[model samples]
Target: MFRWDGGPVAGGFAPAPAADALRQWRSPDGGLWLAAWGAEHRGTYTGWCVDAEAGLVLVADASLYDRDGLQSALGLAGPVLDAPTLLLRGYQRWGEGLPQRLDGDFAFVVCDLRKRCVFAASDPMGMRPLFHRLLPGGGFAFATAPEALAACTGLDARIPESRLLEPLFNAEQLAHFEPEITGIQRLLAAQWLRADARDVQVQRYWTPGQTRPALASTDVDGWVEALRWHLGEAVRKRLADGVRAGVMFSGGLDSSAVLALGCGYVPAGRLQAYSVLDRGNPACPETRAIDRVLAATGVPATCIDVADMQEQAAGALDALAASPRFVSGRNGFLPLFDRMAAASGVDVMMNGIDADALFFYEDLLERQIRAGGYAVALRCARKQDRMAGEAWMVPLVRRLRYTAHLPPVVRNGVRRWRGRASEWPRLHAALLRTDACEALGLRARARRHLALLRRPPPPAGGLPTQTLHGAVNLDGIGRFHARSRHFGVEMRCPFLDRALIDFAAWIPLELRLRNGHLKWILRKAMTPHLPHAVAWRGDKFHPGSHFDRVMLQPVLEQVVRDFHGSGPAIGRWIDRGRFLAAAQRWQAGQIEAVWELKMLLLLEHWLQHNADKVAFGR
Candidate 1:
């Protein structure tokens, strides 16, 4: 609710008539303060500092200051400062000077008034989000929500067509919209944007370290020890600041590892854990297994019964769709987390989202290809030519099925590949249309193309054949972060730490998957801390069970019907008859590709809603 319009006049901005009642808004002597109702129990707080003399403005999330001493440190300036201080905790940093030194789940903007310039950046992993819009008067405005920016400026609110198609056809585009709204754009992960009257420039402050240093012949033990140390450090850093921190524990290896690492840092009763489950879900046993681990670890944990929260599902989806990102119907489980986080008054929610992708890339690809090859080989052996005409269909069907059974590593790889791969054709076509490819800065495009050209080598060991599994995990992480931010809740994935990822990248495939087990190295390292039952759990619990349950709620049916009637963009590519048939099949308990198809349908609806917001012109 904190509002400010520094357009050379006081109280010039329009009033927030629809602002939530729990909101607090203030523009302090040199800064702006806004707090609003967040998630279910917790509230979100943000602050912005405007230094008129130096022309620098600093904005940040309020929850990031439990231990950084940033508040007190910045408070020393007492309303005015000799220079400018834009310090953010729990966010990614950009640029060389003040930006590179900062880290955590965050994104912020700084306006240098003296230089007539503005700058903004997002976290390295793109966990947090910040979006900007160029106003009709040649000035710009930024906000945490697309709705806020659109409401504040004279901008259109209609959804885009690509928003729908992107998620259905190219799932990774769910991270941010295409065409980026003519005068609006999102700060890319690990990138910074600076704008002045003279010019505007955006630059990447971080990049994945692909050139891995070779592992010394005798450094195997040392490498393991280092990996453990870095993992532990990442967990500990997240636990700092004395703020109430909780884990999205599934009793799986990754979450268990996070819980174990955090156990040493958080006090006995202070550590809270949350899980979601459907009473009749087949994965209930796994949730129970996770309960056993949490009980043994002595951390307080809660398993939210999502089946009871039927009415809240639609509202959750609406909130998620308000952002520029794609809303996968799969995230119906997120509302439970949001409600629990709000009710528990917990601020920081740690998740094990990226562990599988970072560590199990090899295993994922092996599984996919193995499954794909098996299907291919089976068909060949049977002399079944039915698959010949639908070459893409075979892999697509196999890939979708493989997703449900994928280990964390393979899941992550598929999400990443799918996101990047879907963009390949479009990027190529765009480049072909434009003669100034070099002038447009297509280096990232080139890198993606090269990666696609490098055909995945055959698995040397007993690994999965699916090379695209990791991409799936990556997309999930991206979607999770974007949606979490939408509700004002911060979900941090410790295993996705840049340091841990870089180190894991160098780990040879042989060690990643051995003896047909996924994440073997991590499992081995966690043996001393995690119970054997938790450490060696063979099957990954399907979080989608609760999602499926929510999908059956009558409200969701109404939502789907309403979206269809609203002329949703998804209606363009979706065969309404096919979608309706799939929905009926899902309702009859014959859910398979129907759920995925529904997700595509919802994505298309979202795209149609935001069609005009894409910024292709800029």
Candidate 2:
């Protein structure tokens, strides 16, 4: 475990010893690097290995990294290798050829004295964070968290006011830090950076791609079969570790597909499935559906009732504020998952997180619109009413209602010019600007959509679609990875494996959203492996639903009190009467407007609390 002066630190160090040691190690050539924090009992250490022959440095949590595999893979001499080992034995994993090939959540930096270079990298999804500051001297200083570096070096930790505003107007951009913080940036996902005295180079090691095959005839069945093959292989690769892996099942099509594929790799009896259910929630019905799928697959499953443990939700909020990514307000799930994983003795936790963006399905209307098949588009749009209760209709309705709230002129123009040749571009632009995109906190969705539309249609019809989905998936994966780092758990998203993503990219949009259903190809491929009910089921709960009941109530009350209190950031940006009125409306179940307001309130607390520690630069 590595410890620095910022964030939460665990260890047994007196105030004087800890402060002095940390200060000495903050200089450019200071022979120390901070690592991730683990449990409270074990004190963290940061220092360099003196031996020239010391191989790669492996720092990880106790739960994930395998010691025997590390020794074998790294070609160590004996049970007690000469090299110094930071035994985050359970959390960090290293082995010969394993470091490069390993997937899932991790952040690591290996200083190769032999090569006189330091190689650092984070997981493809960026579940772990490593920040580096190029010093005035020749050397570079790095740490697991930015706050740690700031604390050690006496630098400020303040974020830019613009970054604070961006999330209000464009919540999706919260994943990125404000550009004003000089010399501070996150390591990109799937990228490796090497720094030596002479130079530093960063390069991406993986890219997800799919190319449509040139065919004399359109054979949809061939595409479907190929998708299944690649997806199965993806799941198998993730289950490579002999240790048991657990799936975060939701009974939805995406998770069911992952669960089924996982079961195929591990024996049914050995595979463990987990799901979260908020008791008394209307969405709990999905949990029952998940139960049915578990029975059909014969996989052992555990359901964590989140409502039963609401207190943990408060802790999740505080942790999120300390780390400060786009606060999802749904972070309570992290603690819930951790408690379950620790209890189950599970090392790897598989989730269906990236499925939405990777295997995104355009509604039936979108398919026809893309084809310029107006009649078909109209037919599907009208049938939307008849298929109102179907699985795909809810998101579609959300999209429509969200789009309807645009400025009066824009909304009226769209309604009047429906289906006209001259109106196509205008209508498309309006739909792209839906408020749901903003409400759901999709940060750069608009900018990305415009970028995609500017490009000419692909010759083979794969690149454009793949680029769109890949960007969205990468952003979500990046955020998920960040949150996992905050929670001290390694989160694995099976759907994000390069092979599975490529397969999803290649599957035709028509097959993905046939007959008004989303994720059709995935559902069809896993039909045999999953229960019929689960295979056909639709409807997903916004895990953030309980935010209003559990979090917002306390947060709003606190915001009001803090607004009245002196010396908080809330007093700076929030107007007293307006903020109070919004809180009252939110209390009356006007939940749609609560998210951005809640984010602002949280930011206020964070800024006030960290004002002294964080330094802002332009």
Candidate 3:
């Protein structure tokens, strides 16, 4: 936090953040204040740094996976330095271009005394978050989380109703498109911000869509070898020597592979697996998958049977909802991580969130048919169907029905013959109140927003954006961030490693989209050593399949009956009667309104808890 001295609409001032960050520092005149929080992990910032001779004061929330590579690039000799020191020296050496040369998740601010400007940047993947507010005369303040920035002394943190409701316009498009959903400016992935007396500017520094790695021409076997090597290295470098790490073992291909790879780097007791098994759904597919993995690997594992924990977690809901930094995750699981941290001392967690986004499943089979590669498409589909225990003819016929050359009349006939789920726009629209959506134009805006995903994603993606979660473009969905923030534990995702992503980018489209499977190359590379059937399996059993029955029906009933059309913010976009009807329908085991209900519930909690204390402008 910082306050401009003698700038427009400003005087002598000091801006204080609300939360107790790990470290806080202030310049003599109180014109600048720096605060940071970091976990005990490689590339973490322990404290703020000031180089009077170099004319720089730096505060960073960073984790550089390739500190050795960065040090080598900067020509820094002598003993290894920390991430913050490396960032400071890199800024001196390469200036703003330093972000391009660096790898890993980072968000940092450098107050450059020589230039009289402050520079900030987040890593290419946005593994860390950065939010800021810019006032008149280029006076600025920023924090790692939006709520933190809102809490600082300098700005009107009261979010406007219009801004508060903007997210509903494209709630289906989950990440990045409207990162400012909380009504604060977010520095996007690969973006840099520069603020000075003259002006404040935000510019994107790297375009992942345009990045082309050099390994594109390698043969299939060579590509597989390269992927295995990169995957191993990605896991190895991120663990950091002597740092205890664990994986959220879901018994899925990605997490299972991470566990297999991680075992090579750490000892038996050092690496652990944490899983959430729903006691109610004991016979679910994931349970079977988990059984297979446990039978095969025999790795030490702890299962958090959450079907019984609702009563225990009940008291924390009000407090969790009351926080201004409202996170979008299973807050119900917060205690499980705390237990993991307390009992097991596992400080770092490796996640497999990026696999779905990076090793994308493509629509090339349909394209192959259109482009006259029928044999190739059939072969791939056959292999995929065999592995999935489905008949090979299903996808072949479906592909034929969906091919572009099929007339609309024929496609309509096929659709009538075999029912298909509605598109995301229609499905997501059902969640909002009809009157609220029309009045606020969310009905139209949501369609327009979702239509953008109809186009093909860049090479660095997992599924068709047309599919659900196509919006999950290698982004961490606050599960890790929420847990880390709540517990002060370090978290890392080897799959989000820049080098791994780059290696995945260069994989030939044939292998990437082959076998009619999502992340075919990744599975092919890992199956040899993954030890479990999950690597060869295509079905990913989502834990939320039973969430409506287990979680929502009981808890959300009160939220629906209790809420009237009264919130200063929610009522404008969510009609009380209509939203109540939707919630009622949802509680009756209907899932059409899941996203809208969940998001509105989150916002209602935010508004109810924060409206008075948030200091809204009169």
Candidate 4:
């Protein structure tokens, strides 16, 4: 991907960047500047400077799997076309329709000196991040990393308090609870942006809202067969020949299914599966299941026991803390895997994340009720129980509480209680400076995000099937990139394929969620291949004690010490008393997980380390 600064020459702009991360280039007259750094992931798609002199600068970070099909569709000559060339050829031939005809995970910018306009677009899931900032005077800068843009432009990078809620409350996926308003304005998935001297425009090229597909049957066999074909194709597309590849196999339905399908496409000798087992927790439930898959597929695996590498893991985590803000605190386990992949010479790692989004159906009862009332809802739920091999009454009662009529307060309370009452960490209101909180409007923003959780399903599509699609792109994929980039590995998620997602959307929910099992259709599809016990396994086991407690406990005092003396940058936002109180509770073992405390530490570390790398504005 290229990081560049550009604006209309008439606007009187000259781009300057501090970091040498990008290769710098300028037009002969010095009117235009470009900085790019890119590498081809697969085939011959070197994504930079197809014809620099022609003022045709194409920067694309892409994994275009169906090169032959796409080249044929775009009518490009020759047997193969690189992603950038494909886009450039498409632009020459079709202009704005280029993005729609291409199918892959990509983010790109094409500078057409002839049109005097810059065109940029992100793939449907935004697999690659594209962030831009309008310069102070009259210019624009874009980069893969938000901080890179900030560093180049010297723009404000102060963490927005409202955006803080995302990392603080939901650490697993630091997903945006609402559309972006502060921080870097990221281009969402399936969107295109065009900017010039006079004006800038952004629009979504694809919307899941309009993506519903009609299916003729609610039968398991029909949907399962379709899913098998789509999922196999998705996995096949993600595999790169001759590249050392690995899968983040956890032996759960998602990971197992990926590993099973992956072996079919990639040679078993070339493919290795990696798993993290609990330290000293020999009774780890996943081991037996993992063994089952290994025996069935003969796919080699290296299981890293968390207990064995405490010191190294701690050091890796410290290195992570010293870097910029990552999406989630739960990523303490990432460094271990990232290092494993790097050392094993695996440049590409596939994950089964978000399989649940497409495979498992949620709020089915709510959608049925919204469409056809109680009789239809109950009938659907009962049918699901029959397929799931379980009792439906209790879950049905649970779903009833979430019907449209219940007051939000009652619904929220019930959900909180059901989710677990004790472990949840409410925001420490007393911690922030009252004036800063008010100025930033964190309270109001938090309330708005909470309200979004209570929003009822839409009538036709239930919840936009795109929720997980957006989430994986916004938080999960970005986080993976941030960590994996350090090791020169590209992480791919087969489940996030646009075709697979569309296929899942087309299937009736009754078929997808059959019996009481989540991803019932997926289980049925795999039953022919994997042992039933491994294929239909219901529970996913997270190994050992959490890495945070294992890694952070030895260093707890240091975290507290750093906060107490964390300087004005941090103290201006977080009150000392509130932080100390939370730390005390965590030390006393009153709380199982101190997400807020971890967030504070991570934020504090990022600010201190990246002081020169980032600046603040609003």
Please rank every candidate by lDDT, starting with the best: 4, 3, 1, 2
Stronger candidate by TM-score (1 vs 4): 4
Model 2, 490: alpha-carbon shift in Å?
A: 0.8
lDDT of 4 by residue, 144-258 (tens): 6665565466655455445543455453343432323333578777889987666789988875435544556655576678788888998888885456778888778888888
Give the Å error, residue 28, model 2: 17
Candidate 1, residue 153: how far the Cα is off, in Å? 2.9
1-618: candidate 2 lDDT, tens digit per residue: 222222232223222333243322121232434333333111112233333345334433212223355555555566633212523221135422233454344566665434545667665555555677665545556666565665445565565543443444333433343222556666766677877777778877655553445432257777767777877877776666554677777677777788888887776455688776666665566767776887777888776555664665665456545554434334345545554564566656677776666655333333334455454434444454444454344455445445533455664456444423322243222222334334433334334333322322222334425343333445555565555444444556667665455456556656665654556677777777877777766545544445334654566677777767763464544445666667777778776546536656555645645665333322
Going through the candidates in order, what is the number of backbone clashes in each?
72, 23, 2, 7
Worst 10 residues of 4 by lDDT: 7-16
Tens digits of per-residue lDDT for model 3, 250-324: 878888888888888887787778776665676566666766776666677777554665643443355445343
- The ten-residue window of minimal lDDT in model 3 covers 459-468
Which candidate has the highest TM-score of all? 4
Q: Pairing residues by index, what is the TM-score of model 1?
A: 0.68
Q: What is the C-alpha lDDT profile of model 1 across 1-618, one tens digit per residue?
A: 112333431223433445534444443342233333333313223556554554445675423322334434444434422112435321213333444445456677765544555667766666666777655445556776655666556565445433323333333443353323445677766778877555668887765443455566246576667678878878877767565777877777888899878888977777788776556664565666676677778887776555565555555455445654555336555645654574576767787877766676534434444445444333332322241223433454345455545565776576666666655454433212223333333435444433533434444443223332234553465567656555545677788676666567666554565444567678778878888877866655555555544643453365468556863444433445555666666677664644445555445434545556554322
Report each candidate's C-alpha RMSD, comma-separated, in the order given.
10.0, 9.2, 5.9, 5.5
Candidate 2: regions farther than 4 A off: 1-115, 118-130, 149-154, 158-166, 172-181, 210-219, 242-246, 263-288, 294-332, 339-346, 361-460, 464-472, 561-569, 601-618
The estimated TM-scores of all candidates read: 0.68, 0.67, 0.78, 0.81
Give the Cα lDDT of each candidate.
Answer: 0.55, 0.53, 0.62, 0.64
As a whole number from 0 to 100, the lDDT of residue 63 in candidate 2 is 22
lDDT value, residue 76 of candidate 3: 86
Q: List candidate 1 segments past 4 Å from native.
A: 1-45, 50-55, 62-95, 134-137, 170-180, 210-218, 278-285, 304-329, 362-478, 553-576, 593-597, 600-618
